[model samples]
Target: MTNAEPPAPRTVVPIEPSLLIAEAFNQAQVTALRHSVTSCSHAAGLTGQRLDDFVLAVNELITNAVRHGGGQGRLRLWRRPGELICEVADHGQGISVRRLSERARPAPDTAGGWGLWLARELSDTMAVETGEAGTIVRITAALAAQPVTRPADS
Candidate 1:
């Protein structure tokens, strides 16, 4: 008998509009956008620290889009079995996503340059698409069951 490896999953495939939460936002509407993302994430079955990481990643992406993506952009969030997925897109001049991925690390104390880095760190898988048209960043993180909380000694 011959053994063969299964085909790899397509990480950059198009996301259907009805698959999950989808919204558009601009610089003026980030606060409300964050809330909506959190709600969608919760509904998609993420909790505990994994949920927190996903939330932070989306916040960074959306904030980056607002500040840099021509002052507006769109966000999409979805799920696939054990994974939670999110995508942030912007219609700006775009960037060298390759360079962004190669960066060693930005200073923690700096106020800027943390968006791409943070998203990569927080998610299990990250993909980037950029061009003269716009840029779309997709990230995926695995969902974990709730951890047991223990009482500390008083």
Candidate 2:
């Protein structure tokens, strides 16, 4: 068999930087919303494990918005260059500072508090904005694998 060099990575150019999916969802719509996010994210060039991870992260955010926020929330998904971004917002009283500051994984016996942790762990980056009016959680995952650099030997 002849040896072949790997093909160079290609950059993805989004057709429209506008939102791919924007919807208001409640508990009943969570499953459907997840499917839509999967389709849009795959179309935006995220695939395989990366795509799965991003979808899961989005699901967690949505669930949290429903369960803790105010029983309803809004979701926005889009892409920017090499990354896919998703934001979930809810109109509840807002998350407390103590809850927002805890980054440690929950204990095995814990009954709740896994959503935000999972979202943060699965995405490339995550941010939260909260106040008396509402809370918004934004997360992003790279659409392409970043190249790993190695130091030259002395």
TM-score of each: 0.77, 0.82
Residue-wise lDDT of candidate 1 within 19-131, one digit each (tens)?
A: 57778899778888888878878887777787788889989999989888889998888777678888999998887756565656787788888888888988888898988
Query: Top model by TM-score, which number?
Result: 2
Which candidate has the top score in lDDT?
2
Badly placed stretches (over 4 Å) of model 1 are 1-18, 145-154
Model 2's TM-score against the true structure: 0.82
Q: Spell out the clash pairs found in candidate 1.
A: none
Model 1: per-residue Cα lDDT at residue 140: 91
Clashing pairs in 2: none
* lDDT of every model, 2 decimals: 0.83, 0.93
